[model samples]
Structures are given as structure tokens and as C-alpha cells.
Target: MNGAPSTVWFDRKRIAPNVPEDLESIDPMCEEIGKVIQLEVDQGIPRNKIIVGGFSMGGCLALHVAYRFQQEIAGVFALSSFLNDNSKVYKDLASSDCRRPPLFQCHGKVDPLVLYEWGESTKDLLIKAGVMCQFHSYPRLYHEMNKDELDKLQAWIDQTLTSS
Candidate 1:
């Protein structure tokens, strides 16, 4: 992760979604990111050794890729991010028997762009669907991430990826 990011950034030049989420827009991007994950597998890397996550809209895409791909990874985290109601990730995890890795979701209590309530709702949905989520909230934080959360997230990553 330090030197190999394996990033897949889709151009954000398309029309905005008419609804809460436009699967049409999201699917293609997820497909490309999925390709990256698959490539890792093809290269003999175990799926459980990979970790995928993002911030804001990128976080939303990461969730889609993780659940749609439906394989175990080291972990996932969503920072100041939220998922639309009835997100397919919920549906997929609810129906699948895969062993999902722990999730490390964090949000600011005062975030305006992605509301704190929205973040909470996303956590609720994921938990309700039986996903293991470690949700964190900052009292005076905003839409951006901070050192505290990053430190905690890094620790979580180390623990999750450690060979136990």
C-alpha cells in the first residue's frame, strides 16, 4: 500500500445523478476498479491480503467494489462517506455467505457535505446486513479526515493485515 496504490480513477465529467444514486454511473467505475482487484488475484495475491477504501465519493465507490466483487479482503474504511438508501452493497452482503473483513467507518459529527446522520445510517445499514463495522465519530470534525482517525485507521489496518 505504501508504494503500490493500484488506483482506478474514473473521470467525473458525466451528468450528475438524477436520483440519490445512479447505478449506471457507478457500475462502470466499479467494473474498472474490480479489474484492478482481479489483476491482483491473477498475480497470485490473496484476496484476504488486500485492503480497499476511500474518502467521500471515493469511499462510496470502494464499498461498491468490495461488495460487488464479494470476496474477503484485509479490510475497508469509509471516511466522511455515506451510501444511498437501499444500496446494493447491503443487498449483496445480506444474501451472500462470504466472510467479509472488518469495516472501519469514520465520520464527523458536524460534517455538512456528507451529513453525520447519513454516515450513521450507512453504518446502521451495513450492520443490519451483518457486516462487521467499527464506526467512529468525531465531535468537532467536518467533512475532512484528521490525524486521530488516520492513526486509528492505520492501527486497524496493521492489526487486520497482520498474519495471525
Candidate 2:
């Protein structure tokens, strides 16, 4: 939840390449993140007290992990990321019984990589699935975070942190 970027290399077990035989890769970075969360939980940190978030690729993984382990996290924050899974993930996301943990997403209107429309599309998918979410899109910004977006994200964490 530091909001800082992490640049760690992934080992084989932590990665699942999206190939014909391995269309769903489990990022090794996620394992590291899970360990961090478990460590905090073991140290008496309330499960709800822990927040998971990241940017771009990290953001996508954050969403994926939160969804994969929904019962373990209180909330999730994903910025400029997309929910990627062949078609199963989308099917799961669109299913009626899917209960989404609280989610926050921010995207740049001019993001060239993931495209702002993808964010909007994800928002629409969540809405269709009855997922409760807070989303924001800034005009004229690219893939990186801006001061305003960070401030808003901070406010969201503050609000969700205290809420049941």
C-alpha cells in the first residue's frame, strides 16, 4: 500500500505465461505481495487493515489477486490496470453471484498503453456484475500518476479504512 513502484524480477513459479498451454500466468510478484500481507496479518494486523494496490502491470495483478483471494482482503486499489484472464476471468467477473470486495480504480484519459477506454470498460463490467466500485479518470494525463489522482486515492483509502 506504499504507492511506490516495485521492480523485482519474477521466478518461474511466480509466473504463468499467457501461452497456448499457459494462458494464465501467476505473477511471482504476487507471491511476494501475499507474503507481505501474511506477515502483517500474523503480526496482529487486522485483515481489513491491510490494503493492496499498484500501478499499471502491478495494478492489474492487484485486481487479479484480490479477486482470486477475495475472502482474504478488505479492499483493493488498482490504477491504470486491466482485469486480464483469457475468458474465464471475464465470465467470473460478469456472473451475477460474484461478490466483489470494495475496489478503487484510477486511470489517465490519455494512457497509451492500457488505454482509458479499457478502464471505462472494466467499470462497466463491474457495474454489470453488481460490483461496488469507485473510479476516476483524469483528462490529459498519461500512464503515470498525477498529484490530484494520488490525493483522491489517499482520501478513498482513508474512508474505506474506517468503514465496515
Worst 10 residues of 1 by lDDT: 10-19
lDDT (0 to 1) per candidate? 0.79, 0.69
| The best candidate in terms of TM-score | 1
Among residues 3 or more apart in sequence or in different chains, the pairs in candidate 2 whose N, CA or C atoms overlap within 3 Å are 14-28, 16-25
- Candidate 1 lDDT over 18-111, as tens digits, reads 1356677788988887788889999998888888899988887888777777357777888988777767787788888876667899999998
Candidate 1 clash pair list: none
**Candidate 1 runs further than 4 Å off:** 1-18
Model 2 segments beyond 4 Å from truth? 1-24, 27-29, 85-88, 93-99
lDDT of 2 at 105: 92
- Number of the top-ranking candidate, with lDDT as the measure: 1
TM-score of 2: 0.77
